[model samples]
Target: MLSKNLLSEIKEKSDLLNSLKPLSPENQAKLDKKFRLEFNFNSNHLEGNTLTYGETELLLIFDQTEGTHDYREYQEMQAHDVALRMIQEEAAETERPLLENFIRDLNAKILVKPFWKDAITADGQDTRKQIIPGEYKKTPNSVRLSNGEIFSYSAPGDVQKEMAELVAWFNENNGTEDPVLLAALLHYRFVRIHPFDDGNGRTARLLMNYVFAKNNLPLVIIKSAAKKDYLAALNRADTGDLSTFVEYIGNQLLWSLDLSIKAAKGEDIDEDDDLDKELELLKQELNQVPNEFEQEKTYSDVANVMENSIIPLFLELNSKIDKIKDLFVKAECNIQISHVKPNGYHDQLFFTSDDFLFGSSFKAYEIQAAIINFNCTALKKTIRHKDINYTLQIDFDGYNYRISNKFKNEELIILPYKTFLSKHNIDSIVKVVVSYVIDEIKSATNLNI
Candidate 1:
């Protein structure tokens, strides 16, 4: 099983990856080329688009030995090569091929081979002798394996449904969860299913790497030297234990993250920055802000500010939005205070679109009055007395004015105003809201209302 300490280390590695900025276009192209090279190295066996146990093993050995082996090695390698090539050729091309299609293709190819189908003979008698076909041994259709026995291969019928479910799950959740964990789960599940007649291990690893590439992560290699530990993890997964598999995959993810981060930084990965702690603190601070705003701030208000105001502000401060830390510091503003009492209070405040009220606890009418005041100042218009009840209205010229008292709060709805304003970019409304709030707070507190 993977220790908790190792899991913590993996989390740190993931945090480091998340902290990285996007690479430059030139660097991105370079990284893509490197990734493709590694991918091709691992996937080159399927050049014929068919696979069988023999062909798969041949490719595995070829990848390991670079085809520089002696006669004995070549004989052993032939089984793997033949198996993989047959499988690839039989697999039907589809717009979106599935894992089962790959396995079924391999199975059909291997089953038709006379060498695989014919019973072995000993002592000139056709006494059936067991032979290891491709890479794995066959068991009775309903039998299970004991310790030290060959890896049991299941027929295509036994695993088709399970494989389909796995692929469906991967497609749906690929982008929703952490990619590293998602890949790990997929890898473990695929290996546990063990759906192919042979070469299931290699195919499972290939699927794992496919998921990694789909998620824009680096490719992971399961070395032959580590095959024992890999099988142990799969065994644990078979027994419904996943801690070991999670750890094994988490370690691979850490390695990928470390390499990618190093390449991006143009140096060895650093450990000094406590990014997780910093992020935690920032989240806590954001959570402390209350939801209520005196000026009726809707969900759209915050979204607008973040997307248009905050994002652009950061973009202007730095060429890219990667320098979020600096942007936060620069965007900080003091909260202006405002107070309002019932007596002697104007029904509405006049303000322009440029005013922003920061903090004020007053009735809606007082808030409206402050907005009117600020709007009149910016528009250079005279303040006209009107009997508008709790509604504050602003014109297109950045002037804030109130309707007559006959205007009812219920009828002074925002739908028409919203529809009219939508023609202009919503950011313009955000600026108006910010300015209105700032002025309202100042006016209410100054006049003790």
Candidate 2:
């Protein structure tokens, strides 16, 4: 419920905007552009879309994207724009009722398509989950907050029932309540439910604006720059302080109202941060020019690889496996580099040479000599404990770097060569390496974990 003074304030602004009949063509275009950019850029940015305001404007208005963003990010921005226009059209049809399918369609539209995302389970295990856009989640979902606490949303089982109830509540009180208040409450309620797996926040904002559009009010923009405040308000609402969030939302509506009045009065409606956004885009464009010549890979590059990637990798494995060394009768760790034999039966087999060893620094000449003497097929680390053996290997063939062990293998191809063997990458390899050794021990010893 809104305070009487706030309601009166909103009514006054609404009345003034209404008195300005139809805005001129120029004013209308300016207002549309402003609203479109504000809504699209902020809404998606709140959900971690990396496009800057200038990039978003370029993509949405000029249909020319100027960034190295993921293709999906660009697609979602365009899809969200389409959904924005769609809701405006829907809002114009007064006879049309808000339906669950319509809301689901908005979710589907903004998300673009189904895809898989990396997720962490409640037990803190890494896993992949498929996002089915426009549909309710099939499994449970939760988020880890800034404070490192897990916040779970409404369970998947209750989504359909709660959503139906939400829509009914909104439609029942649609025209009677103050439009801004209604929009605010509608946004909060929809977010509380979190109906869709992904895009719930984006969808909630869209739905909130739907109420404003239907009531002929200026749609509020939740600026991404103020995400902390926005989320803080939502957090307060979670603790039964709904009015705090309502007030926060009301203030955002005031901004939209103020901008609308300016646009209606044919005044300059450009934001204060517009110049900053332009300069940022200018800098990004200036930095995107390519160097004239490409650097060739040399022996020093291999030596750097040995120092930065291979040596650290072996030490990391040694540190982890050293913890369980007591369980084995005897544990030995060795570095093995593959030497491929042309037109031989064991061509693919990796054989160890005295030249390649872990923890030993190799000079540029030494790396050159090793590569020249041995037809290097792969680099491998093998841990032998009693009769059990475990291996972690990197198989690179000029095109892809594939890290494989007994448990799992991952291809680190998209990342740059220098950064392909990152800490996270090494951790993943180490995890599987440790898990493989543990599993082998368990199998041989028949020990219950």
Candidate 3:
């Protein structure tokens, strides 16, 4: 029988559990597998056992009846092992910098391990190596997963810097705001960075759960079965869109919370609440508050909106231009705008003017204009006033194609018929670029228009 203290502790945990809804049997099974794996990994390490990839994965198999054939994948084994070790090390650390150092160290090791020999040529020549700040020259490779898709193994330099900044920011704001949302944002941002040439997905998932563990929440696993949805969530995040990923992960977390709550109560789990409704309600509440006070908006407010919001928009826009440039051969177009020289100027039109707009507003307008210009230039040809279809030659297919249009903007340059058809087929790519621009614009200005 459980002791009085154990029962009391269980009751205390139950009270916390009451705050969550129940989860489905499928979700419950997933949560159970993840918890078991995490538990076994931690327990083994605590008992002074060095864990391997195979062992880590076997721990995830709650029942052996399904057959162990699928667990034969070596990469999966390696990924699980590294992920568990990182989680264990993070859980063991009490200090922030130390925790970060451990994570970074793990990231470096995972990146170089599988691709080490391949990272160098047979002649002993170094291949494409990455320069991590403290880790020095490390080999980063693009490894193809079992799904035939390739992913990089090293954290990009910019992503590493952003992660460092985010870690610092978290240390400063950890207790002041809601930890769940903070953790979500951290997870979203980390995955968006896609750091590491190889284990980025697994590492990101671990880091996300690490944030949850820091907040005393159960670990959330994005199972291989949910890999498609997971990738979709991440792709949405890549374009600075968080709604899908947030909804997806939040649901997973709520499911875990429910199961843990049920286990605490020593009762058979029934049903979990739909977190989407609760999340929507929370978002609505957040939207009602002034941007200056909202936690997500705090960085924007403190950083003068321009540096925090506008510059990122510009960078996002630049990335879009690069994408559009890639679709067309011999269609080299450089998009740039003159920086607005600050002179004490104020008026509605002046505020709207390219010359007078400053800070975030300037950044927003410039990017918005650049995107519109690029799209229009890619589509339209000659501008016509009144009823005339003005004729003009626009570059397409390594040849200038004669085209006409009824619009007045010279900024519009229409590609030829064949070129337009070919480009339209890649509409998803275009949507990604446009969505990236839109997300950045919204982030920078919060301009509903």
Candidate 4:
């Protein structure tokens, strides 16, 4: 339903960008970095991430984070970057069909993990609901409009059916339809469905770009500054005028094309505002007190936490695993220490003894993280699976400490330096580890217990 004029404009821009073909490696890399930062910063900012553009660049590119925002904000930004890379890789597989599970995985990657969120019930009562990543909503969701009216999405019971139809329509018209229009429609339909409890907006944007990437078109960004216009276009689409939203997306695509074409011609693509923003950030950094910037724990602090908190947690985990060891033919637990040496090198050294900390050599280096691996060999004729291995990892980034499994980069819990680790922390860590072990045992041994 796009007007001929708009469609022609989009075609012209697309052709112009295509004519440039491959850009220089250096130029392409610069463009990629620019878009990565811009996309991550703007998309999350639209959804209320408090990290500034400069802070986003530092965190994503340099692994250096600043500001005093909740650690969850930082974690979500990183997770969104992961989801971006995932779509890029996924788009490259031209032969593979896009499926519901892939979309679910994308949602999971963006949200990072299941957690509870505050919500308002239909009767206007405030409540909290658990958001399970990669799954359709079990509870209904709605939004409040600028006019103070409630705007409801598709009902929870109807979501599965609607989503199946949406995916089918997308796959059916994917190639034949104009990629820009296809991207816009995909975004609109997904938003209408609101399949997940949280992260629906972010997920919708990613899926829209996935369509563009598959078509080898420039990735369109919905600038956070222009969020009002973007929402207005969606509101217009809600009234049955879908073409306006398509035109809005087409215009955004044109912006991307213009930027890409400039990069192709070796022109400066950075806006004047970028420098101004950088200067503002510099001023803020200079005005802050010294203690405000000292958010990260020192090597000595790391040593203290490992000794006082981590060792006890590890011992507790070992004791719990020991109780379940008899269920398998061969079950063993081991510990490995990860730390930075005096030479500024990172190393992971194996430790065999339960009292491994008693050695003087352990205190010689700066400890950063620890790993515990539990390995089990299933009893023949007793268990079907041959071997089961699970790993728990605890590490401190410069700004925060995290506990997670070695196989997955997802953090189970992120703790700040101020809280460090308490008895409550130890209990939470042990609970997760023990639960995972039990689940793995049940799956491997087929025992209900």
Off by over 4 Å in 3: 1-15, 18-34, 38-82, 85-89, 92-99, 108-112, 116-160, 268-449
Residue-wise C-alpha lDDT for candidate 3, range 250-323, written one tens digit per residue = 66666566568766545654333223323322432333344442233222232232333223433443455565
TM-score: model 1 vs. ground truth: 0.38
lDDT of each: 0.41, 0.70, 0.43, 0.78
Alpha-carbon lDDT of model 2 = 0.70
Across residues 122-154, which tens digit of lDDT does each residue of candidate 2 receive? 544446689999999777666656454667778
Q: What count of clashes does model 1 give? A: 54
In angstroms, give how far residue 182 of model 4 lies from its true place: 0.7
TM-scores, one per candidate: 0.38, 0.64, 0.40, 0.63
Q: Which lDDT tens digits does candidate 1 get at residues 24-76?
A: 66666555444433333333322211122222333443343211222333333
Best by lDDT: 4
lDDT of 4 by residue, 1-449 (tens): 77898888878878888888799998899899889988998899777676767678879987877655568889999999999999999999998878999999999998888898777565544477999999999887876554546678899999999999999999999899989889999999999999989999899999999999999987889998798899999999999999999999988988998999999888999896777556544533443334455567777666666666666777777777688777678877777888787788899887544675573234566887888787777744242546667787878777656667678564555554554555545664576566566555533433321
Better of 1 and 2 by lDDT: 2
